[model samples]
Target: MTETAEQAVQFVAMARKSFPALSSMRGSGGPAAAAVRSAAPMASHFLRRRGEDLLMKAVQVETEAGLANVREIAKVEGLDMVFFAPVELAASAPRGQEAGLLLALETAEAEVKRAKKLLGGMLVPGRSAEMMFAAGYDLVCTTSDVILVRAAAENIVREAKPPATGPKGGLVRFVTSGREAKFARNDETLVTRLKKSRQARALGALVRLGSAAAAELVAASGFEVVVLDHSRGAEDLLGAVALVHAASRAGAHSLMRVPALSQAHLRRALQVGVEGIILPGVESAEEAHALVELCLYPSRNLRDDSHAAEARLKNQPFRRMDFSFAPPLVEFYGQRVAEFSRRQGEALLIAAQVDSPEGAAHIREIVKVEGIDMIFVDAMRLSGADVERIETAAKKHHRLLGGLLVPGCHVEDMYRAGYKLVCAASDHGLLAEGAKACLKAERPVE
Candidate 1:
């Protein structure tokens, strides 16, 4: 067996001792486990059987107290990453607080960068590709809000700009009332104007291009590690893949966000070569532990030749070898899931969504799980103060904490509090534009 695989087995064995509950879940007589053993080779089966060993603890924090608490946990228990919630721009620039907001964001970025430099490793919120580029965040998470905002921003810009000028002797010059924008020689203002008039119909096309641009920005920024927010549906997966492909082409790493910790989504994401899986709504350590198992090992319990063939057919050259499997769907599923849990040992990062006080309470136990790597508090559902309280409590329990930012959340406050990785929903295009803007601002003027 490979050293990594062997190491995985050892970790699983150790984990079994610490997390007996996981063993119970994989009941001794469970047909799924037995089926994997009977079908796959003994070595593969052993690796698969040792799935639970690779779990790690992670959490989400959204307040200064929470940040301090997370720092305390990191010092004591080796916390993984601190994801700040809602790393986004304020709607309308926060009415007279734009400077303050910008300063806060800059400060947060500086703090996160400092932590990474000093602490060896750190995760930060990258709602847009520009944010990721500007901050050099380790993890970039795209959100729907950012996407929509970017699209709107792009449309406004496109509409605001006058159209291209056609050939001198060709189409008539069409100009919008706003300052007769001058174009360079050979520019096609007429064509540009026509394109702008048809903007409504071309919104889809623009968004797609924008999405690709965002992914490209993330890729070019040298922050290749990105986690796409895919909690919405399977359709979002395609967009995430597109972004990954674009990012990869530009020299970045990409991970897909799964709807939840289900085998189906995990299987699909893996098939596409997503570097990691972002699981939502994970309420317990058992669930987190199970997710880690699924990510590392192949699922030996499921089988389907058609699926294997399909994966092979759509293969990309940039795909990772970790996902290069051809076993029957059932067997592959069991093997991957089991192997992932056993060998990787908590390396499988999870962004559990906590929307309620009850869920917040459950986070403590979830962090205690041997394999859970991160916890992402959902700001859309939890108040900032409540999230802070949870982080404080979690710190007392020696758990790492993170926070999530949605449409109307106070992300800056979360950053100040010490939450590291903030996410917007899934809007790849917006992320690209934002990244581009950030890049432009940082570049030296000619």
Candidate 2:
């Protein structure tokens, strides 16, 4: 049988085993539950290899000791691992602006290079475009908090110029500054001063541009996966789509975040052909089932048949729908949901948006959902006290917890807290800004 057909058959079998009770839960819940049970096995079968081959086996390393800990985890996790190295080690400087920051950037870049050479590929959080592009890391995660910084860096780079020429056309002077520095002849005081000032204002712009450029470069260099950190709105969808298209063109994999899993947003994202969906705020099995149902071809809700036909004609997969649910409730309903998703042959992801004091308890319950393939933690909702609790719970359960944040949050902070995936809000400028941010976030840092 063809791979797709074989997958469908496997899904049916797994559904039967996972949700025997699905037959009894008649009504809206019944079908959804059955679908998930059915789909889980098939989804698992397809995803297992991909997860093993492409998913970054991220490790949180704060120091050399932490690196050692990560190495141990890699061994236990099997082969082809990627570590999310600490941002402080990779981005922060020990002292002033003179050499410390530069040293830090270089160190971070070297560390990533070393890891990629040793581990085959790894994920890393980066501050500068140079570090991110130079390191050759597999994936790079960005936080909403740093958008301004990114924009600044891009602007600086854009304004930079080659060394100026003297009256006789000899080289005049070279300005060595951040990534934005420009070169000009000593005689061209007026132009250099204006350029320097302009560069200062464009610092944030420069960073943003650099981030995007870095993503393009990474894809061109032949990375396997690119994930974007988008937490707020749908603005990042286009950027995500662009990255996906670019990566696909480059023969790489691309993934992005849909701030939430609404039907409209999910459809739009799927239309763009994103390989994965990072749904935030999922808390229950029923919700998980609902998401799976949405991912299926016939979808729980009716869709325009014409659109499906068109997608097929264009060689595009039909868009999958997604559902969101709060916690505690998913625990009781996840199995049914998994069954329904399996029967339908769709992709489903469970997002754990831990915003309340009871989030840890809720996550503990969520981990038990038999067919849940992935888990996302809404860090924006999670308080400082809840970080360790949630991390420990997710780890013990062997569930993947993605980190999410609003604009201005730190990717390193989330990584340090044990979040392998980081999503940031996409709304800042236009809807396209969010879209672009999503794509850039997903691009591997290397």
Each candidate: what lDDT? 0.45, 0.42
Instruction: Please give the distance, in angstroms, between residue 397's alpha carbon in candidate 1 and its true position after superposition.
Output: 4.9
Best by the TM-score measure: 1
lDDT of 1 by residue, 195-237 (tens): 2332211000111332667657655654424555565533454
lDDT of 1: 0.45
TM-score for each prediction?
A: 0.38, 0.33
Task: List, residue by residue over 278-317, the lDDT tens digit for candidate 2.
Answer: 5556665556555543444222321223344333323311
Residue-pair clash count for candidate 2: 75
Please give the TM-score that candidate 1 achieves against the real structure: 0.38
